[model samples]
Target chain A: MEKTILHLDMNSFFASVEQAANPNLLGKPIAVGGGIKKGSVVAACSIEAKAFGVKNAMSTWKARKLCPHLIVVIGDMTKYIYISKIITKMMVDYTDLVEVFSIDEAFMDITKTQDRFGGAIELAKDIKRRIKERFKLTCSIGIGPNKLIAKLAGELQKPDGLVVLREKDLPTKIKDVQVKELCGVGRKTEEYLRLLGVRTIGNLNSYPREKLVKSFGMAYGEQLWQMGQCHGASEVRPYFYETQAKSIGHSYTLPKLTSNTEEINGYLLRLSEQVGRRLRRENYKGNVVCASIGTGDDKTSSHQKKIKDFINDGYQIFKVAKSLLAITNKIRFVSVSVSGLLHQLDQISLFSHVENQKKVLAAVDKVNDRFGEFTIERAAIMSTGLQGKTGMVPPKLYGLRNFKMELRGIEPLTSRMQI
Target chain B: MVKVGTIIKVGVVFQGSKIIPRWFIWESRKYEVRSLDFTWEESQGLEKIIRFSVRDGINSYELAYNTIQMNWALENIC
Candidate 1:
C-alpha cells in the first residue's frame, strides 16, 4: 500500500507557547531568545515579529533595530518541552507509528489508521483542532504520500495551514520551489547546485544523474535526485525506538568569558561528571574521551584520545579532559564527551581495583538520582560555584525516558521482585 | 514592575491533580490570584521549583514553589 505520512509543525513554537501563557503577548510582536545581551540570538519569533523581517537566530540587537516594539523574552526550555510532550501524547492517540522530529515537529504514518478517522486530511484537521483547543497554540500540518513531501508541503503555508500533497500534485506543486526547500539541502549544497545550474526542483530533475553523482558522492547524489522527485523514507519508526547512542557529551557556556584556567577546569570537571553520570545511567562505558574548548574569539579546538580501559567515572574523564585543556587559553566554553562505547558488563580483574571505584560511584549515583542531579558533588567542582548548574537536559524526545527501563532490558520497577 | 525574590506565603487549592494558586501574601500585602496563565517546573540540582504565571488585577506575577525547600517565593512581577 502507498504510504500516507502526515507532518505537524508548531507555529513559532516557543513564542507561541509564551503567548498562550500570557494573554498580553497575543497578536503582539515578540521573540523568544537569550538575555537582553548584545550577542543573544532570537530562538523563535511570532508571526507579528516575522512581519517586521525579524527572524530566528538573528542577533537580538539587530532584531530590536528591525522592530523597535519587538518584545524580547528569555526562552523557557522546560516549559516548551512540557508542552511538546502533551502534543506528542495527543498524536499517539491517532497512530502508533509517530516520529518526533524535534521539540515542535512530528511525523505520523497514518496509512493504515486514516480510514478510522475518515481520511488523512480529516485526521490532520482534527489533530490540529484538538491541539489548538487544548494549548491555545496553532500548527501547520501536511499530508503527503511520504515524509519529505509532507514536510515541504507543510512549509508551503504558515501559522495554521493544512496542505495535502499527493503524487499527482508533485510536478506542478514542487517544480518552482527552491532546491533548498527540500530537506538536507544546506547553503553549501545550494551553492554547488547553483554552480551546476540547478536552482529549482525542476532544474534538479532535468540535470543528469551521473553528473550530480560526480558532484556529490553516490549515496547523497541519489538521495538528492529522489528528494527532487518528491520522494522520502516511507517508514515512520515509533518515537521510543532506541537507535544506539554513538556518543554522550555535555558542554557549558560560562556566564562570563574568562581566561582563568582554574575556573575553566572546574567547569570541565562539572561537564565531565554530567557525561559520566549519563553513561553510567545508560549502562555504557567508553574507551575514548574527547574535550573541546571555545575561546572568546569564537574559535573552537577539540582533542580526543583512546584510553587503555573502558571507563565511566567522572574523575577519570575529567583527568583526560584536563590534559587536553593544557594547550588552550582564553577559553569561554568547555565540553567533554565520550565515544567508542561498550555495553557495560561485570568482569573480575585480578590485578585491577576498579570494583571499589564502581561501588562508590554507584552509591553516589543512587543518592543523586533519589534526590536530583548534583545533589552530591565532587570536591574539585565544589569551589567553582557550579553547584546548582545542571548541564542541558538532552531533550526527552517523545517522552522516551519513560520507556528507558524497557529499552535497557530491565524489568519495570513495579514488576521487579523486591529485595 | 516590581522585582522581588522575597519568600512569601501562598494558599494553594488542589483540584484533582492540578495545583491552583488561590491567594498569596508578599511584603504584608495580600493579593488574590485572578487567573493562572501558565505553569512550568524547573530543577536545580535536587531542588524542583514549579512556577506559575499568575495575574491579580492589573499586576502579573511569577509565583514559585520549591519542592525541596517547602516554601513559596514571589519570583518576579510585571
Candidate 2:
C-alpha cells in the first residue's frame, strides 16, 4: 500500500480568530498586523479586505486606503499560540507520527493507521470539520504520498478546500502544472527557470540532472529534480506530549531611540539569561551566538561569534555580547540567536555553577507554571528595575504557564484583557 | 509560501511538474487573493496572470466580472 500524508493548514488563522470572537468584524475588510506605526505592515487580511489590495507585509495604512472601511486590529499572539497548541493536541491524538511543520501547519503519516481512521480522505475531512466547528474558522487539507506533494496539494486548494492526489492523477493533469508548483521553488527560482524557457513542471522534470545542476547549484538543482519525481522523504517526526526547543533567540526593537549602553546591555543581559536557562532546561548546547542591532537612523549592525567549543553559560554569552554591541553606537533594535545546537548532554564539560542554576531555573519555571506568573524573579534581574510592558510574551506551552487569552472566553482564565 | 499580500487571479496557473493552474492574473501588479483563483481575461480587463495556482475542483464563473479583477488584485494595481 502507498504511504498517506495529510497536510492541514488554517485559513487566515489570526485574523479569523479575532473576527470570530468579535461579531462586529464580520463581513468587514479586516487586517491583522503589527502596529499603526508607519514601518509596521499587515500580517493577515480577510478575503473581503484582500480584494482591496491589502496583503501581508503591506503597511496597515495602505490597506486602509485600499478599503477605506478596512478594520485593522493588532495581533494577540498569546491567544493565537494557545489555540495552536490545542489544535496540535487534536492532531497528535490521531497519530504518533506527526511532523509539526509550523505553528499552523502539520503533516501526519497515516499509511500505517489508515485502516483505523477509515481512510485518508475520511481523516482529513474529520480534522477539518472538528477545527471549523470548535474555532469557527476554515482550513485546507491535501493528501498525498509524500510531504512535498501533500503540502503542494494543500496549497493547490485553500480556505476550506480538500484535494487528494495519487500517482494515477499525474501526467495528463499534473504534468501541465507550472514549474513553480513544485515544493521549494521560490520566486527567484521561478523567474530564473522562466528565463531558461522552462515554465511547466513537465519540462523541468525532463531536463537531465547534470543540466539542472549546472544551471542551478548542485544541491538545489538535484532537489528540484527530486521534487519533480516526488521521491523525497515524508517521514513524520515522533509526536510527544513534551517537545524539545529547536532554537533560542530574542529580538526587541528599542522602545525609545537611545545610544545608552547601560540600557542596552541591561536588556541584553535579561534576554541572554532567559535564553540560557531555557537551553539548560532542555539539555541543549549551542556553539554559535549572534548579536544583531538596528540603529536609530534605521541602519542595522550585526555580528556573530562562534566559540570553537560551545558553552550554554548565560553570563559568558553576555560577556561576548558586550563587545559586539560596542562596535557601533546608535541603537533601535537588538537581537541574539543561539545556534549549532546539540540535542542533549555530552561528557565533555563540567560546571557546578551551571548545574546549581539549572535546578533553580527549573524550579522557578515550575512555580511560575502553577501560580499565575514569575511571581518570584531573580535578584540579579532586579538590578534593571522594571523593563516596562511588551507586546510579546515569553514562548510558552498551553498548560506550562498561566496560558490566559487577553481576549476573554478563548480560554477559561482568571483575568481577562478587554478591547 | 503565499503571503497575505500576494496577488493572484483566475485562469490557468502553473508551478513546475504540475500544469493544473486554476488561477491567473491579467495585471502586472502584485495581489493577495483571499479566495479561489482562476479568473477570465475579458471580464477583468486583463488577459492572464496568476500569482499562483490552486485546485478548487471547479474554477467558478460565479466570480465573473468583465473587469473581472478582484478588489484585492486591483488595490495593488493602483
The candidate scoring highest on DockQ is: 1
lDDT of 1 at A313: 91
Off by over 4 Å in 2: A241-247, A253-263, A294-301, A307-315, A326-332, A342-367, A370-388, A392-419, B1-78
- For model 2 chain A, give the 10-residue run with minimal summed lDDT: A399-408
Per-prediction TM-score: 0.88, 0.70
Per residue, candidate 2 scores C-alpha lDDT tens digits across A1-419 of 67888888888787887666453466788888765665556888887787778887786777778888878777756556656766766776576577666666778888886677788888888888888776677888988888888887887886788999886775555677887777788999999988887888788768788878889989988998887676667787643424555557777665566677777887787667666656665677788888888876768777888887566666767777766766346677787767888877654338887668656666776665444233555555566653422343343322221122211123321122232
Among these predictions, the greatest lDDT belongs to 1
Q: Write the per-residue lDDT of candidate 1 for residues A1-419, one digit (tens) a residue.
A: 67899999999999999888877788999999865665567999999999999999887889999999999887777788767877777887777677878778989999988998999888999999998887889999988899898898898898799999898878988889899888789999999999999999999877888888888999999888888767798888777666677888887666567788878878888878878888888888898999998887889999999999888899999999888767446766778999999875556666456777778899999888667666688988878866756433332211334333322332222234243
